[model samples]
Target: MLASLRQERILAAVRLHGAVRVADLVDELDVSDMTIRRDITELARAGLVRRVHGGAVGPDTGSRPAHEPGFEAKRSWATAEKQAIARLALTLVEPGQAIALSAGTTTHLLAHLVAADAALRPLTVVTNSLAAAEALHAAVTPAGLDVILTGGVRTPSDALVGPVADASLAQLRVDTAFLGVHGLDGDGLTTPNLLEAATDRALLAGAAHVVVLADHTKWGVVGLARIAPLDEVDTLVSDTQLTAEARRALDPLVGRVLLAPPDDPTPEPPLDPGAP
Candidate 1:
Protein backbone atom coordinates (compact mmCIF):
# COMPACT_ATOMS: atom_id res chain seq x y z
CA MET A 1 0.00 0.00 0.00
CA LEU A 2 1.04 3.59 -0.54
CA ALA A 3 2.49 5.39 2.44
CA SER A 4 -0.39 7.83 2.64
CA LEU A 5 -2.93 5.08 2.49
CA ARG A 6 -1.08 3.02 5.07
CA GLN A 7 -0.77 5.98 7.40
CA GLU A 8 -4.42 6.86 7.02
CA ARG A 9 -5.29 3.30 7.95
CA ILE A 10 -3.11 3.51 11.00
CA LEU A 11 -4.89 6.69 12.06
CA ALA A 12 -8.21 5.00 11.52
CA ALA A 13 -7.18 2.02 13.58
CA VAL A 14 -6.13 4.19 16.48
CA ARG A 15 -9.35 6.18 16.32
CA LEU A 16 -11.45 3.05 16.32
CA HIS A 17 -9.59 1.28 19.06
CA GLY A 18 -8.52 4.33 21.10
CA ALA A 19 -5.01 2.90 20.75
CA VAL A 20 -3.40 0.21 18.67
CA ARG A 21 -0.61 -2.24 19.38
CA VAL A 22 2.54 -2.18 17.28
CA ALA A 23 2.40 -5.90 16.72
CA ASP A 24 -1.19 -5.64 15.46
CA LEU A 25 -0.21 -2.96 12.98
CA VAL A 26 2.78 -5.01 11.84
CA ASP A 27 0.65 -8.07 11.27
CA GLU A 28 -2.16 -6.18 9.61
CA LEU A 29 0.12 -4.24 7.29
CA ASP A 30 2.61 -7.06 6.83
CA VAL A 31 5.43 -4.74 7.76
CA SER A 32 8.40 -5.53 10.00
CA ASP A 33 8.44 -4.59 13.70
CA MET A 34 10.98 -1.92 12.95
CA THR A 35 8.77 -0.51 10.24
CA ILE A 36 5.80 -0.34 12.59
CA ARG A 37 7.92 1.33 15.19
CA ARG A 38 9.00 3.91 12.63
CA ASP A 39 5.40 4.51 11.64
CA ILE A 40 4.27 4.93 15.24
CA THR A 41 7.14 7.31 15.86
CA GLU A 42 6.08 9.43 12.92
CA LEU A 43 2.50 9.63 14.16
CA ALA A 44 3.68 10.60 17.64
CA ARG A 45 5.80 13.32 16.12
CA ALA A 46 2.79 14.75 14.26
CA GLY A 47 0.88 15.39 17.51
CA LEU A 48 -1.71 13.00 16.22
CA VAL A 49 -0.95 10.21 18.66
CA ARG A 50 0.58 9.52 22.06
CA ARG A 51 2.82 6.45 21.89
CA VAL A 52 3.23 4.26 24.94
CA HIS A 53 5.40 1.21 25.35
CA GLY A 54 3.85 -1.01 22.68
CA GLY A 55 1.10 1.10 21.10
CA ALA A 56 -0.14 4.63 20.29
CA VAL A 57 -3.21 6.43 21.61
CA GLY A 58 -5.49 8.77 19.69
CA PRO A 59 -4.81 12.47 19.49
CA ASP A 60 -6.21 14.63 22.27
CA THR A 61 -9.83 15.15 21.19
CA GLY A 62 -10.04 18.56 22.81
CA SER A 63 -8.06 19.97 19.86
CA ARG A 64 -8.37 19.59 16.06
CA PRO A 65 -9.31 16.91 13.51
CA ALA A 66 -12.80 15.72 12.58
CA HIS A 67 -11.60 12.14 12.74
CA GLU A 68 -8.62 10.42 14.30
CA PRO A 69 -5.36 9.82 12.49
CA GLY A 70 -4.24 6.23 13.01
CA PHE A 71 -1.21 5.61 15.24
CA GLU A 72 1.16 5.04 12.34
CA ALA A 73 -0.22 7.97 10.32
CA LYS A 74 0.00 10.62 13.06
CA ARG A 75 3.48 11.73 12.14
CA SER A 76 3.30 12.33 8.43
CA TRP A 77 6.11 14.87 7.89
CA ALA A 78 7.44 18.21 9.06
CA THR A 79 7.66 17.03 12.66
CA ALA A 80 11.00 18.76 13.35
CA GLU A 81 10.08 21.95 11.55
CA LYS A 82 6.76 22.28 13.36
CA GLN A 83 8.36 21.66 16.75
CA ALA A 84 11.07 24.20 15.99
CA ILE A 85 8.49 26.81 15.03
CA ALA A 86 6.63 26.05 18.25
CA ARG A 87 9.78 26.69 20.29
CA LEU A 88 10.37 30.01 18.57
CA ALA A 89 6.80 31.04 19.22
CA LEU A 90 7.19 30.31 22.94
CA THR A 91 9.91 32.96 23.05
CA LEU A 92 7.31 35.59 22.10
CA VAL A 93 5.20 35.10 25.24
CA GLU A 94 6.11 36.76 28.52
CA PRO A 95 4.94 36.27 32.08
CA GLY A 96 1.45 37.51 33.07
CA GLN A 97 0.29 38.45 29.58
CA ALA A 98 -3.15 37.68 28.27
CA ILE A 99 -2.60 36.03 24.92
CA ALA A 100 -4.88 34.57 22.30
CA LEU A 101 -3.98 31.54 20.18
CA SER A 102 -5.53 30.61 16.85
CA ALA A 103 -6.51 27.11 15.86
CA GLY A 104 -3.97 25.05 13.88
CA THR A 105 -1.27 22.42 14.29
CA THR A 106 1.51 24.98 14.56
CA THR A 107 -0.32 26.96 17.20
CA HIS A 108 -1.17 23.71 18.92
CA LEU A 109 2.54 23.08 19.25
CA LEU A 110 2.90 26.59 20.63
CA ALA A 111 0.33 25.70 23.27
CA HIS A 112 2.40 22.70 24.34
CA LEU A 113 5.58 24.76 24.47
CA VAL A 114 3.91 27.28 26.71
CA ALA A 115 2.66 24.49 28.94
CA ALA A 116 6.09 22.90 29.16
CA ASP A 117 7.79 26.05 30.42
CA ALA A 118 8.13 25.93 34.23
CA ALA A 119 9.08 29.53 34.87
CA LEU A 120 6.03 31.11 33.25
CA ARG A 121 3.07 31.33 35.54
CA PRO A 122 -0.58 32.39 35.79
CA LEU A 123 -1.17 33.11 32.11
CA THR A 124 -4.52 34.42 30.95
CA VAL A 125 -5.02 32.46 27.75
CA VAL A 126 -8.05 32.82 25.51
CA THR A 127 -8.86 30.63 22.53
CA ASN A 128 -11.73 29.59 20.29
CA SER A 129 -10.20 26.21 19.62
CA LEU A 130 -11.14 23.27 21.81
CA ALA A 131 -7.75 21.63 21.36
CA ALA A 132 -5.84 24.81 22.12
CA ALA A 133 -8.04 25.56 25.11
CA GLU A 134 -7.51 22.07 26.41
CA ALA A 135 -3.75 22.28 26.06
CA LEU A 136 -3.56 25.69 27.69
CA HIS A 137 -6.02 24.71 30.37
CA ALA A 138 -3.97 21.71 31.31
CA ALA A 139 -0.81 23.77 31.34
CA VAL A 140 -2.03 26.88 33.12
CA THR A 141 -4.64 25.81 35.67
CA PRO A 142 -2.21 23.56 37.48
CA ALA A 143 0.10 26.52 37.77
CA GLY A 144 -2.82 28.68 39.03
CA LEU A 145 -3.44 30.52 35.78
CA ASP A 146 -6.74 31.44 34.13
CA VAL A 147 -7.88 30.23 30.70
CA ILE A 148 -10.98 31.42 28.87
CA LEU A 149 -12.43 29.45 25.95
CA THR A 150 -14.96 30.95 23.56
CA GLY A 151 -18.12 28.96 23.16
CA GLY A 152 -19.71 28.55 19.74
CA VAL A 153 -20.42 26.00 17.11
CA ARG A 154 -17.63 23.45 17.01
CA THR A 155 -16.17 22.64 13.59
CA PRO A 156 -14.23 19.68 12.24
CA SER A 157 -11.03 21.65 12.65
CA ASP A 158 -11.78 21.87 16.40
CA ALA A 159 -12.57 25.59 16.33
CA LEU A 160 -15.49 27.19 18.15
CA VAL A 161 -17.30 29.68 16.00
CA GLY A 162 -20.71 31.21 15.21
CA PRO A 163 -21.93 34.39 16.98
CA VAL A 164 -20.86 33.53 20.50
CA ALA A 165 -17.11 33.40 19.91
CA ASP A 166 -17.24 36.60 17.91
CA ALA A 167 -19.16 38.46 20.58
CA SER A 168 -16.93 37.13 23.34
CA LEU A 169 -13.76 38.26 21.57
CA ALA A 170 -15.11 41.74 21.08
CA GLN A 171 -15.73 41.98 24.81
CA LEU A 172 -12.09 41.36 25.71
CA ARG A 173 -8.65 42.62 24.66
CA VAL A 174 -5.28 40.87 24.77
CA ASP A 175 -1.64 41.90 24.88
CA THR A 176 -0.33 39.51 22.25
CA ALA A 177 -1.82 36.86 20.05
CA PHE A 178 -0.49 33.81 18.20
CA LEU A 179 -2.42 33.13 15.00
CA GLY A 180 -2.57 29.83 13.15
CA VAL A 181 -4.08 29.46 9.73
CA HIS A 182 -4.44 27.28 6.64
CA GLY A 183 -2.45 29.61 4.38
CA LEU A 184 -0.63 32.93 4.17
CA ASP A 185 0.31 35.09 1.20
CA GLY A 186 1.25 38.59 0.07
CA ASP A 187 -2.44 39.52 0.26
CA GLY A 188 -3.19 38.19 3.76
CA LEU A 189 -4.04 35.08 5.76
CA THR A 190 -6.52 32.49 4.41
CA THR A 191 -8.38 29.45 5.58
CA PRO A 192 -10.48 26.80 3.83
CA ASN A 193 -13.51 27.60 5.97
CA LEU A 194 -15.37 30.88 6.15
CA LEU A 195 -16.38 30.54 9.80
CA GLU A 196 -12.80 29.89 10.83
CA ALA A 197 -11.74 32.99 8.95
CA ALA A 198 -14.20 35.11 10.90
CA THR A 199 -12.99 33.71 14.20
CA ASP A 200 -9.35 34.42 13.39
CA ARG A 201 -10.22 37.93 12.26
CA ALA A 202 -11.92 38.57 15.57
CA LEU A 203 -8.87 37.34 17.49
CA LEU A 204 -6.63 39.66 15.45
CA ALA A 205 -8.90 42.61 16.11
CA GLY A 206 -8.85 42.00 19.86
CA ALA A 207 -5.05 41.76 20.23
CA ALA A 208 -2.50 44.57 20.57
CA HIS A 209 0.10 42.70 18.51
CA VAL A 210 -0.50 39.69 16.34
CA VAL A 211 2.22 37.12 15.65
CA VAL A 212 1.35 34.59 12.97
CA LEU A 213 2.72 31.03 13.23
CA ALA A 214 2.51 29.41 9.83
CA ASP A 215 4.86 26.82 8.37
CA HIS A 216 6.43 27.21 4.90
CA THR A 217 3.77 25.18 3.11
CA LYS A 218 1.12 27.80 3.97
CA TRP A 219 2.87 30.63 2.12
CA GLY A 220 0.95 30.58 -1.19
CA VAL A 221 -1.97 28.20 -1.08
CA VAL A 222 -5.30 30.02 -1.29
CA GLY A 223 -8.21 29.46 1.02
CA LEU A 224 -11.78 30.77 1.39
CA ALA A 225 -11.41 33.73 3.74
CA ARG A 226 -8.93 36.52 4.35
CA ILE A 227 -8.18 37.21 8.03
CA ALA A 228 -6.24 40.44 7.66
CA PRO A 229 -4.56 42.74 5.20
CA LEU A 230 -0.87 41.99 4.82
CA ASP A 231 0.31 45.10 6.63
CA GLU A 232 -1.77 44.37 9.71
CA VAL A 233 0.29 41.52 11.10
CA ASP A 234 2.82 42.73 13.71
CA THR A 235 5.11 39.77 13.29
CA LEU A 236 5.41 36.71 11.06
CA VAL A 237 7.25 33.60 12.33
CA SER A 238 8.03 30.66 10.10
CA ASP A 239 10.58 27.89 9.72
CA THR A 240 13.77 28.17 7.59
CA GLN A 241 12.26 26.04 4.84
CA LEU A 242 10.42 29.11 3.52
CA THR A 243 11.39 29.84 -0.07
CA ALA A 244 13.07 33.00 -1.37
CA GLU A 245 9.92 34.02 -3.19
CA ALA A 246 7.86 33.68 -0.02
CA ARG A 247 10.43 35.64 1.98
CA ARG A 248 10.39 38.39 -0.62
CA ALA A 249 6.61 38.42 -0.65
CA LEU A 250 6.40 38.61 3.15
CA ASP A 251 9.15 41.20 3.67
CA PRO A 252 7.17 44.15 2.33
CA LEU A 253 3.93 43.48 4.19
CA VAL A 254 4.65 42.51 7.79
CA GLY A 255 6.28 44.72 10.42
CA ARG A 256 8.86 42.13 11.51
CA VAL A 257 9.50 38.71 10.02
CA LEU A 258 11.41 36.24 12.24
CA LEU A 259 12.99 33.37 10.27
CA ALA A 260 13.86 30.56 12.71
CA PRO A 261 16.82 28.39 11.75
CA PRO A 262 16.15 24.73 12.43
CA ASP A 263 19.83 23.96 13.20
CA ASP A 264 21.59 27.20 14.16
CA PRO A 265 21.52 28.57 17.70
CA THR A 266 22.48 32.11 16.63
CA PRO A 267 18.98 33.27 15.89
CA GLU A 268 18.41 35.68 13.02
CA PRO A 269 17.00 39.11 13.69
CA PRO A 270 13.60 40.22 12.47
CA LEU A 271 13.67 41.39 8.86
CA ASP A 272 13.38 45.15 8.55
CA PRO A 273 9.89 46.16 7.52
CA GLY A 274 11.15 48.94 5.23
CA ALA A 275 14.29 47.36 3.76
CA PRO A 276 13.83 45.97 0.31
Candidate 2:
Protein backbone atom coordinates (compact mmCIF):
# COMPACT_ATOMS: atom_id res chain seq x y z
CA MET A 1 0.00 0.00 0.00
CA LEU A 2 1.02 3.60 -0.53
CA ALA A 3 2.53 5.57 2.38
CA SER A 4 -0.21 8.21 2.21
CA LEU A 5 -2.97 5.58 2.35
CA ARG A 6 -1.25 3.71 5.20
CA GLN A 7 -0.84 6.92 7.21
CA GLU A 8 -4.50 7.76 6.67
CA ARG A 9 -5.52 4.34 7.93
CA ILE A 10 -3.29 4.72 11.00
CA LEU A 11 -4.79 8.12 11.79
CA ALA A 12 -8.29 6.69 11.47
CA ALA A 13 -7.45 3.83 13.87
CA VAL A 14 -5.95 6.19 16.44
CA ARG A 15 -9.02 8.42 16.27
CA LEU A 16 -11.33 5.46 16.71
CA HIS A 17 -9.46 3.86 19.64
CA GLY A 18 -8.00 7.01 21.32
CA ALA A 19 -4.78 4.95 21.39
CA VAL A 20 -3.41 2.23 19.09
CA ARG A 21 -0.41 0.02 19.78
CA VAL A 22 2.39 -0.29 17.23
CA ALA A 23 2.23 -4.08 16.98
CA ASP A 24 -1.53 -4.07 16.38
CA LEU A 25 -1.20 -1.34 13.78
CA VAL A 26 1.53 -3.28 11.99
CA ASP A 27 -0.61 -6.42 11.83
CA GLU A 28 -3.70 -4.51 10.74
CA LEU A 29 -1.86 -2.56 8.06
CA ASP A 30 0.17 -5.57 6.87
CA VAL A 31 3.24 -3.35 7.05
CA SER A 32 6.63 -3.74 8.66
CA ASP A 33 7.19 -2.17 12.09
CA MET A 34 9.73 0.28 10.66
CA THR A 35 7.28 1.37 7.98
CA ILE A 36 4.49 1.94 10.54
CA ARG A 37 6.83 3.93 12.77
CA ARG A 38 7.84 6.13 9.88
CA ASP A 39 4.21 6.73 8.92
CA ILE A 40 3.31 7.55 12.51
CA THR A 41 6.28 9.90 12.74
CA GLU A 42 5.19 11.74 9.62
CA LEU A 43 1.62 11.97 10.87
CA ALA A 44 2.82 13.30 14.19
CA ARG A 45 4.98 15.88 12.41
CA ALA A 46 1.86 17.07 10.59
CA GLY A 47 0.13 17.54 13.99
CA LEU A 48 -2.49 14.91 13.16
CA VAL A 49 -1.52 12.61 16.05
CA ARG A 50 0.60 12.54 19.20
CA ARG A 51 3.13 9.71 19.37
CA VAL A 52 3.10 7.81 22.65
CA HIS A 53 5.41 5.02 23.83
CA GLY A 54 3.77 2.13 22.02
CA GLY A 55 1.18 3.94 19.95
CA ALA A 56 -0.35 7.21 18.77
CA VAL A 57 -3.02 9.42 20.29
CA GLY A 58 -5.30 12.00 18.75
CA PRO A 59 -3.74 15.40 18.20
CA ASP A 60 -4.26 18.07 20.84
CA THR A 61 -6.02 20.72 18.78
CA GLY A 62 -6.30 24.00 20.64
CA SER A 63 -9.69 24.49 19.07
CA ARG A 64 -11.10 21.38 20.75
CA PRO A 65 -11.89 21.52 24.45
CA ALA A 66 -9.54 19.68 26.82
CA HIS A 67 -10.70 16.49 28.52
CA GLU A 68 -9.20 13.82 30.74
CA PRO A 69 -7.62 10.82 29.11
CA GLY A 70 -8.76 7.28 29.94
CA PHE A 71 -7.26 5.29 32.81
CA GLU A 72 -5.08 3.08 30.61
CA ALA A 73 -3.71 6.06 28.71
CA LYS A 74 -2.75 7.82 31.93
CA ARG A 75 -1.32 4.64 33.47
CA SER A 76 1.18 4.49 30.62
CA TRP A 77 2.41 8.07 31.14
CA ALA A 78 5.01 8.97 33.84
CA THR A 79 4.97 5.35 35.00
CA ALA A 80 8.31 5.49 36.82
CA GLU A 81 7.33 8.71 38.58
CA LYS A 82 4.00 7.25 39.66
CA GLN A 83 5.67 4.09 40.99
CA ALA A 84 8.20 6.12 42.94
CA ILE A 85 5.44 8.23 44.46
CA ALA A 86 3.54 5.07 45.35
CA ARG A 87 6.57 3.56 47.05
CA LEU A 88 6.99 6.68 49.15
CA ALA A 89 3.27 6.87 49.93
CA LEU A 90 3.33 3.25 51.14
CA THR A 91 5.80 4.18 53.88
CA LEU A 92 3.04 6.26 55.47
CA VAL A 93 0.72 3.25 55.86
CA GLU A 94 0.80 1.36 59.14
CA PRO A 95 -0.60 -1.98 60.06
CA GLY A 96 -4.29 -1.93 61.19
CA GLN A 97 -4.73 1.57 59.80
CA ALA A 98 -7.60 2.57 57.53
CA ILE A 99 -6.82 4.64 54.41
CA ALA A 100 -8.97 6.07 51.67
CA LEU A 101 -7.65 6.03 48.07
CA SER A 102 -9.32 8.48 45.75
CA ALA A 103 -9.82 7.40 42.11
CA GLY A 104 -6.63 8.02 40.12
CA THR A 105 -3.85 6.13 38.36
CA THR A 106 -1.34 7.08 41.07
CA THR A 107 -3.68 5.87 43.82
CA HIS A 108 -4.24 2.68 41.88
CA LEU A 109 -0.46 2.15 41.90
CA LEU A 110 -0.52 2.78 45.65
CA ALA A 111 -3.21 0.12 46.06
CA HIS A 112 -1.09 -2.40 44.14
CA LEU A 113 1.94 -1.61 46.30
CA VAL A 114 -0.14 -2.01 49.44
CA ALA A 115 -1.51 -5.35 48.29
CA ALA A 116 1.96 -6.65 47.46
CA ASP A 117 3.60 -5.61 50.73
CA ALA A 118 3.33 -8.29 53.42
CA ALA A 119 4.32 -5.79 56.10
CA LEU A 120 1.36 -3.52 55.39
CA ARG A 121 -1.19 -6.27 55.80
CA PRO A 122 -4.31 -6.19 58.00
CA LEU A 123 -5.26 -2.76 56.69
CA THR A 124 -8.55 -1.32 55.54
CA VAL A 125 -8.73 0.57 52.22
CA VAL A 126 -11.71 2.66 51.11
CA THR A 127 -11.64 3.73 47.46
CA ASN A 128 -13.73 5.14 44.63
CA SER A 129 -11.64 3.29 42.03
CA LEU A 130 -12.92 -0.04 40.70
CA ALA A 131 -9.39 -0.71 39.46
CA ALA A 132 -7.94 -0.32 42.96
CA ALA A 133 -10.55 -2.65 44.49
CA GLU A 134 -9.98 -5.30 41.81
CA ALA A 135 -6.21 -5.13 42.30
CA LEU A 136 -6.61 -5.64 46.02
CA HIS A 137 -9.17 -8.42 45.57
CA ALA A 138 -6.84 -10.38 43.29
CA ALA A 139 -3.86 -10.14 45.67
CA VAL A 140 -2.22 -13.36 46.82
CA THR A 141 -3.00 -12.57 50.45
CA PRO A 142 -6.19 -10.57 50.22
CA ALA A 143 -7.45 -12.00 53.52
CA GLY A 144 -5.53 -9.45 55.56
CA LEU A 145 -6.53 -6.44 53.47
CA ASP A 146 -10.10 -5.19 53.63
CA VAL A 147 -11.19 -3.19 50.57
CA ILE A 148 -14.34 -1.07 50.59
CA LEU A 149 -15.37 0.02 47.11
CA THR A 150 -17.68 3.02 46.71
CA GLY A 151 -20.35 2.05 44.21
CA GLY A 152 -21.22 4.86 41.80
CA VAL A 153 -21.26 5.82 38.13
CA ARG A 154 -18.01 4.93 36.38
CA THR A 155 -16.22 7.78 34.60
CA PRO A 156 -13.86 7.51 31.60
CA SER A 157 -10.97 7.46 34.05
CA ASP A 158 -12.62 4.41 35.73
CA ALA A 159 -13.43 6.48 38.83
CA LEU A 160 -16.67 5.68 40.64
CA VAL A 161 -18.39 8.99 41.26
CA GLY A 162 -21.81 10.50 42.06
CA PRO A 163 -24.11 10.64 45.11
CA VAL A 164 -23.73 6.99 45.96
CA ALA A 165 -19.96 7.25 46.30
CA ASP A 166 -20.20 10.48 48.26
CA ALA A 167 -22.76 8.99 50.68
CA SER A 168 -20.63 5.88 51.20
CA LEU A 169 -17.52 7.94 51.95
CA ALA A 170 -19.36 10.34 54.27
CA GLN A 171 -20.30 7.57 56.71
CA LEU A 172 -16.76 6.30 57.28
CA ARG A 173 -13.55 8.04 58.33
CA VAL A 174 -10.03 6.98 57.44
CA ASP A 175 -6.59 7.80 58.82
CA THR A 176 -5.38 9.17 55.49
CA ALA A 177 -6.70 9.85 52.01
CA PHE A 178 -4.44 9.46 48.93
CA LEU A 179 -5.75 11.68 46.15
CA GLY A 180 -4.80 11.68 42.45
CA VAL A 181 -5.69 14.70 40.41
CA HIS A 182 -5.80 15.77 36.75
CA GLY A 183 -4.36 19.18 37.53
CA LEU A 184 -2.93 21.11 40.47
CA ASP A 185 -2.26 24.83 40.52
CA GLY A 186 -2.18 27.74 42.98
CA ASP A 187 -5.97 27.59 43.09
CA GLY A 188 -6.31 23.89 43.97
CA LEU A 189 -6.34 20.34 42.69
CA THR A 190 -8.90 19.84 39.96
CA THR A 191 -10.49 17.28 37.65
CA PRO A 192 -12.24 17.53 34.32
CA ASN A 193 -15.14 15.42 35.56
CA LEU A 194 -17.38 17.41 37.91
CA LEU A 195 -19.00 14.39 39.57
CA GLU A 196 -15.60 12.85 40.23
CA ALA A 197 -14.56 16.12 41.85
CA ALA A 198 -17.52 15.87 44.23
CA THR A 199 -16.61 12.30 45.15
CA ASP A 200 -12.95 13.29 45.71
CA ARG A 201 -14.10 16.02 48.09
CA ALA A 202 -16.05 13.45 50.06
CA LEU A 203 -12.97 11.24 50.29
CA LEU A 204 -10.99 14.23 51.56
CA ALA A 205 -13.61 14.94 54.23
CA GLY A 206 -13.55 11.32 55.39
CA ALA A 207 -9.81 11.32 56.15
CA ALA A 208 -7.85 12.98 58.93
CA HIS A 209 -4.88 13.54 56.60
CA VAL A 210 -5.25 14.30 52.91
CA VAL A 211 -2.25 13.43 50.71
CA VAL A 212 -2.30 14.59 47.10
CA LEU A 213 -0.35 12.23 44.81
CA ALA A 214 0.41 13.98 41.53
CA ASP A 215 3.24 14.12 39.00
CA HIS A 216 5.00 17.25 37.77
CA THR A 217 2.97 17.06 34.55
CA LYS A 218 -0.19 17.87 36.49
CA TRP A 219 1.15 21.20 37.70
CA GLY A 220 -0.09 24.40 36.04
CA VAL A 221 -2.78 22.57 34.08
CA VAL A 222 -6.13 23.46 35.64
CA GLY A 223 -9.11 21.21 35.19
CA LEU A 224 -12.76 22.17 34.85
CA ALA A 225 -13.73 21.66 38.49
CA ARG A 226 -11.82 22.34 41.70
CA ILE A 227 -11.63 19.57 44.33
CA ALA A 228 -9.76 21.33 47.13
CA PRO A 229 -7.12 23.95 47.77
CA LEU A 230 -3.50 23.09 48.57
CA ASP A 231 -3.82 24.28 52.17
CA GLU A 232 -6.30 21.48 52.81
CA VAL A 233 -3.69 18.85 51.82
CA ASP A 234 -1.55 17.44 54.60
CA THR A 235 1.15 16.27 52.20
CA LEU A 236 1.77 16.69 48.49
CA VAL A 237 3.74 13.78 47.01
CA SER A 238 5.35 14.27 43.61
CA ASP A 239 8.47 13.09 41.75
CA THR A 240 11.83 14.84 41.95
CA GLN A 241 11.31 15.93 38.36
CA LEU A 242 9.25 18.72 39.87
CA THR A 243 11.36 21.88 39.50
CA ALA A 244 12.91 23.64 42.49
CA GLU A 245 11.08 26.80 41.50
CA ALA A 246 7.77 24.97 41.45
CA ARG A 247 8.45 23.56 44.91
CA ARG A 248 9.19 27.05 46.24
CA ALA A 249 5.95 28.30 44.71
CA LEU A 250 3.98 25.42 46.23
CA ASP A 251 5.62 25.66 49.66
CA PRO A 252 3.19 28.07 51.25
CA LEU A 253 0.12 26.49 49.65
CA VAL A 254 0.44 23.03 51.25
CA GLY A 255 1.53 21.81 54.65
CA ARG A 256 4.32 19.63 53.27
CA VAL A 257 5.87 18.54 49.97
CA LEU A 258 7.63 15.19 49.55
CA LEU A 259 9.68 14.62 46.41
CA ALA A 260 10.09 10.96 45.41
CA PRO A 261 13.31 10.47 43.51
CA PRO A 262 13.02 8.12 40.54
CA ASP A 263 16.41 6.41 41.03
CA ASP A 264 15.83 5.69 44.71
CA PRO A 265 13.28 3.00 45.45
CA THR A 266 13.26 4.10 49.07
CA PRO A 267 11.50 7.35 49.84
CA GLU A 268 13.69 10.43 49.82
CA PRO A 269 13.82 12.83 52.76
CA PRO A 270 11.39 15.70 52.60
CA LEU A 271 12.68 19.07 51.38
CA ASP A 272 10.86 21.10 54.03
CA PRO A 273 11.31 20.87 57.81
CA GLY A 274 8.76 18.98 59.94
CA ALA A 275 7.37 17.17 56.91
CA PRO A 276 5.64 13.83 57.43
lDDT of all the models against the reference?
0.72, 0.80
Best by lDDT: 2
TM-score of each: 0.68, 0.73
Off by over 4 Å in 1: 1-77, 263-276
All candidates: CA RMSD (Å):
11.6, 9.4
Q: Residue 19, candidate 1: how far off, in angstroms? A: 27
Worst 10 residues of 1 by lDDT: 267-276
Q: Per-residue lDDT tens digits of candidate 1, residues 92-202?
A: 898888999876666766776676676667678888877666666555665556788998987656778878999999898999989977667788987656777888888
Model 2, span 157-246: residue lDDT tens: 888999999999999999999999987878888887889889999999989999999987667555667899888999999988776766
* Highest TM-score model number: 2
TM value for model 2: 0.73
